[model samples]
Target: MPSSWTVLAVITVLTIYFCKNKRYRWFYIFAKTFRRDFRGFIVYVKTAITARLAKIRNETVVSVFESLVKKHPEKAAFLFEDETWTYAELNKFCNKIARYFRNEGYQKGDCIALMLENRPEYVGIWLGLSKIGVVTALINTNLTNDPLVHSVLAGKCKTIIFGSLYANVVKNVAKDLGFKSFYQFHESTTKEDFEVLPEFIDLRSKLSNISGDILSSRERVLADIQDPLLYIYTSGTTGLPKAAVVTSIRYMFAARGMTFVLRLKSNDVLYTPLPLYHSAGGMLGAGQAVLSGITVALRKKFSASNYWKDCAKYNCTVAQYIGEICRYILVAHNNVEPVKHPVRAILGNGLRPQLWKQFTEKFKIKEVYELYGATEGIANMINLDNQVGAVGFIPWHARWAYPVSLVKCNENTGEPLRDENGHCMECGINEPGLLIGKINQKKSIFAFQGYADQKATEKKILHNVFHDGDSYFNSGDVLVNDEYGYFYFRDRTGDTFRWKGENVSTAEVEAVISNLTQLSDTVVFGVEIPNSEGRAGMAAIVDAHNSLDLHLLSNSIKNNLPSYAVPMFIRVMNSVPLTGTFKLKKIELQADGYDINKVNDKIYFYDTKLKGYAELTKDIYEKIGNGTMNL
Candidate 1:
């Protein structure tokens, strides 16, 4: 038995020893993150954990939303420009949607595609449809023509509810589609401002004529946690958009995790300008309002110039972003005085380390909850300690609790490296490898609801991970974790390449180029160039119709994609050479690179100074190669 003073001395010595070395900082980070998440965890538990954990196990997005609406009926739910809607008002509107759809005979498991832009009504339509168990396929508003037609048809949607703004575009494709009905939603009461296409049913007037009361017992039973709720489209590596099935439990997980990890307050007004069709805006952004009773301010679309101004106008305390959104706002809104802005915190991913420090310092951001996850992938991580460039982390002492790992894999192809015993090898500290998460049915956080396509879903699963019989979700992302357990996103699978600090999916770019070229064959691939951090995009198109207009193509590319996504170079050919299997000979084209001396095709460079695609001259090509030309 030692003296009290001696015991205290020993405890102090042990504490100091454990907190020693710079490499042993995981203990501090774990404590900090745990303390920060404590409140959210308690609240989540008090709210009955999740739809999966509830007593009835019948918990769902609709039921949880109903609970929040009942609890905070008078609270402001959404603010869009000059309009504001209380939780009660929003709920009533959603009820009308449910009633209308039910009365019209839309049954459980029915699908309706929504092609509306970001608006309060957009949220209402999806929420309401979910009440009667109809899966809403959130179509990207930026898509046009063939790609738009593919997105709608992929979901097997018999009906499509589009905004009045997209009336003409929808009308052009209406004949091609097999939709039973086309419902049009007017953005304003003065619908005369926009043409009401004769083919579209007046959804606004129809909803106005229905009852806004709660659903009748005889109407329909809402969805279960395991049931499909929404279909969110993710750019597929194969081609076209893949409809990812977002189950009710999956939605609950995203919303609850965001609210908890962000430590959102009831008074927090979130300003989200990201498109609503994506999960970042649809599930996480809108979920904050629907699940937690927080006020959300909607933006029609992202305007970098108006980023902070909107925050100040909406009295927003929090903001949301994704991809190059932070970079866009940082560069475009450099004149914005951060001191006067009401935003104190930001939530998003895709902010590079160099840009992270600059953006936070310039904007006076106090907290940035940077996150890493996928729409269909199971692995999810968040940066709670504001670790620069780190997507998220799992402490070394608690990796068992996380069920995620970075396994050694082929750097280019992303195939997991295996040992002689047929077991996957885990990457060591600072070594980049494929990030994977174990699929456990009992753990809802690690549960992968997967995409709507059975083949697509099966393609993402990697088996025999660690044991003889084990499985993991293939994230298709290469990540490096340091000794402190901070995970940094390095790169993605070979098909996807990083450009301007953003992942550019070749398949998606090719899809856009193919459509823009009047259904001509296209091969989009990333080409490495001197004085570049990542690969630069180069697209090769087959001008089958010989109607390719360089100026029009340049303008369309700008409108369709982000600055980083646009290809820097273009090659025009009579036909794209194919491999033995009838696939585009990407290997041959990629090996050819962008060297003017090596390829016989007519090449053109996207010259920013000239503001259009210019035929590649020998001198100009040399300038690009020598780093004199800034892509």
Candidate 2:
């Protein structure tokens, strides 16, 4: 061989020659393949490694609260009818309430149920309990006896704090329930006679006796970052609502994700009209306020007509919304000048892709942080960095990554098919798949509090598939991951039914129907239409005693839903069936499919020609079945 320098010179000359020739360049590329793979691996490794580093600690919220109290004591924390609470006053009040709970045989980890409306006291009680490490289970105030009772009992709450407005409902249910203590906030809309318990104590009187010293002492009882903070109930596709144990770690993640992802600041004020019982209102909205030390303007219930006015009044920089809320707001008359408020951003879940651009442009919202997360599911997606209509990507991790698989769904049974390997293969980019959260024992962060039924909880969990001895949380939601790895929501798996070559979610359709205030309640489902390839969209609605404004109702749905998704048949009912927990019972409605001859209830059909829905006469029903009168 030649000298070593000669060999090096020869190699360099060969490399340069190869680089210049396109065909020979392949050899050079082949030689650098390992380096390319190594560089890509480094990027993947870095993203996976630094994923959880930016997560906020649970104590950060309370620390921020303390800072706000010191920096801006007189700033309003909450405003309600004839009442306003300053940050300092609210913090002190919450501390005192927490102390009272601690002194009254309550300890960290104990569950306390809160059944109150959107009021100042509700905030105080929730914040106070959170400070003391008490897991507060929020009961839906609209839920009647059995569901109301089941939720409280399911959460295993020993004590309950309820608004006096729900005293009658609570009293009827409490006698059978084994709650240790009951504290009633002295605020009620009803003056009707109701039984008052002798043991029941007024919240105001208890707070009066607790001095500022007690409040300060109680602040020392700070909870660890991983401790349980909330137990929120989510109604699954089937069964009663199950309580999902929300840890401080998850709450912190939510707070940090909302702040950095949505770019919320201390100066930004958020308008939230969603119920506090829901995760969007509690963790996403209220949690953001606590962590960012931002002001939250609360509304008891959503009112499309009043939504813009409230945003202007509160000088809201951002607003929280759900899919249904957005649809309702869109249906309202378009404003002459959309950029009316100081609002710059809107954040929430389930906003449809079709309505995404319209909502942003019409409302003058600069950004839409369409986040995706179940109340209990560990995996979360935030549209950080202003990626519209797409849930942001999750960094790769062996344990925490959400691998989506397009399951082979059976046409007859409507269930997914499994392979011999048991583990489902991931779908190609842009294809919808059932999103499953990978569970690793070391990194698994969530636990389902579950409903009263343990079997119900077990059914939701899938174990031992990907790794010989691993488990994963079944989110029950279908999602699509694009080439960029950003996820887009498809539909809830079990809730969506095939109809006319398209999948229809009753939740999505009901969202459109529920916007009409004329209906007391609405349930949408798929009913088998004669000669149809799949189920046809149908709606059962509890109309007001007076006749329904069919013209207005049809117009609302047409404006909101696509032609294929809109209910072809509308059945008017005296009442819509619901579970004890206020969840719409669709099973009974689905079973009771439309039959004009057998059904006593009046049915109507959407008359595309009439530009409105009309009564379903026997002749019309037959014509629809015969395809003579198209829906």
Candidate 3:
């Protein structure tokens, strides 16, 4: 993949010495590798070039989408269920949203939170708000109670627009939210959608009163490409969700980056069932229709049984997924024409090696475009060669140019390991190490925008990394690179754990559980189950008197946290294992997990059928570990 043979030969020899891989199988394999690596490098260069030109032209998310509306007016911009919205129609919907906010005196710097289920309107609302330079916070629709309230407040939002389905939830937390306005939107327009809880305003009614046309020049804010557009929240290593600022520049880089990587065509349709709050579904998926003039097939939510049917129905050429989608698709009964679907390529993160193989084979997929990145950091990677397990690859020679690298770090403390010279050490080939990205403030694509919380932002930056004045964005994830230069995700070295395709903070769960159980010394962690893509939640609490109320704990957790954050297993202990310093020691407890043979403490499993926690017997443990129970 080198421009010169000398560099390529040197790298080949080094790869052979380090990886100890068998000799290159055949000439055809070598030819294929050369082609893929070269092509991938071209994509990286192209993406950077396009992003820079957009910045120079002062193009933003709003301006880009407006151009597309004029270029492909009748093209299907989004397909949802049986509905299809053309590029022009989608633009009209967004115009109404922009006009409403602009007319209400929402200034350029105003911020509003939006919580809605995945639909065409979800993208429209945020994009519309961007027109007036009003940053829109994309709140996870699954959040409830305290987490939900925290999200709205974390964005520093003065107003919130929520879907009608969440009216009761918003009403309960309305008093907690002391901010200005509340607007509820009902997806259905055929029925009377004016219904709202008490003082809440109906967004649909307001929009209906206004003309759904393009905003006048005088009506718009002086938007810039670098202006903040969306506040997408992520649980970054701590308890509550931290809002990550996504500017028009950042969104364009990710969206346009994929356009080049996938060699996307105008006729290609993208199927995205993932949540709009997450970057995958929001920027990468929806960004296609807005920026690239491709059609996007949006779903309200993922349905394993209907996945393939939906793909064939929409004639989708591409599909999106996360870790949990693997279990869903593999375990489903069957979708009509499961193997005959038109989906050829997949784009998403958290697809394990085994899942990648099974998924591609089952669906006869031509390519699996596995990717890796975090919400705030800019260490983006893409698996271009369709390597079975690799999340991405960085050629040895390319490291000099690429901003990302793996550095030796303490697995326990989550700190980079420095040498006697006080410099971070690079991991050897195939060595697991912490991934970091060099921050370049001038380059929007390489900048670490960090979280809305500046203190939290500082927590993620490692200063004096390799040299005196250099700093790097510490991506809490650990990864390993092979002799072939392909990177594979190893494990996360933080308190956060992934479940149900969402990041569940142990600190958050502990707080909620401890509060419900009379201030018990509760510790929460993740436990691994065989055949599961991600870890399952488990909690340990001190209850020497055997007075812990399972019913109350279950109800409280369900009401406070998202369903995924609720622990699947709970262990009752007389006292939690603590270190000599009186800190809760989670290492051994997480290792014991819910194994009946290993865990001597009383263990209980959340019984969905019973609507409460039930004693975790040996039989129940066996059923869960062996994949026999669907519960």
Clashes of 2: 1
Please list the residue runs of candidate 1 whose C-alpha ends up more than 4 Å from where it truly belongs after superposition: 1-48, 55-57, 335-339, 497-505, 508-522, 527-536, 541-566, 572-602, 607-612, 616-631
Ranking by lDDT: 3, 1, 2
Better of 1 and 2 by TM-score: 1
Candidate 3 residues lying further than 4 Å off, grouped into runs, are: 1-32, 192-194, 333-338
Query: Using Cα atoms with residue i matched to residue i, what is each candidate's TM-score against the true structure?
Result: 0.85, 0.70, 0.94
**Per-residue error (Å), model 2, residue 141:** 1.6
TM-score-based ranking: 3, 1, 2
Q: Write the per-residue lDDT of candidate 2 for residues 381-419, one digit (tens) a residue.
A: 666545667765542221233443334443322344567
Give me the overall lDDT of model 1: 0.82
What tens-digit string does per-residue lDDT give for candidate 1 at 1-631?
A: 9999999999998888876875356666667667544543454454336544742567788888889888989888999989899989998999999999988889899899999989898989999998888989999886766667888988888799999888987887898896778899988878567767777789998988998988887875656778888999876456667899898878878887788777788889998998889888988998899888889999998898888889989999989987468867776766755546788788888877878888888888998888898888778888876888889877676677667999999764678899999989998989999999999866666777788788888888889989978889998888999876788998767577767644567887887777777755888888887745568899988887678998999998876665777899999888888978898887688778778899888899888898889999999989988967778
lDDT string for model 3 (1-631, tens) is: 5578889889988778755654443344456468777998899899989999998998998888899998879999999989999989998999899999888888797889998899999999988888888999999998888888998888889899999888888888989998667888887886664467668888888899988877888888878888888999998887788999898889999999999988899999999999989999999999999899999999998998888889999999999998789668877844434466888898888888877777787778898899999867878899997898889888765777786999998887567899998989999888999999999898877888887789989999988888999889999989999766789998887898898899999988988887778756988888888888788899988899989888888888899889888899998999888889998888888888888898788899989899789998888888997988755
Best by TM-score: 3
As a whole number from 0 to 100, the lDDT of residue 146 in candidate 1 is 67
Query: Residue 592 CA error for candidate 1 (Å)?
Result: 7.3
- lDDT (0 to 1) per candidate: 0.82, 0.68, 0.87
Better of 1 and 3 by lDDT: 3
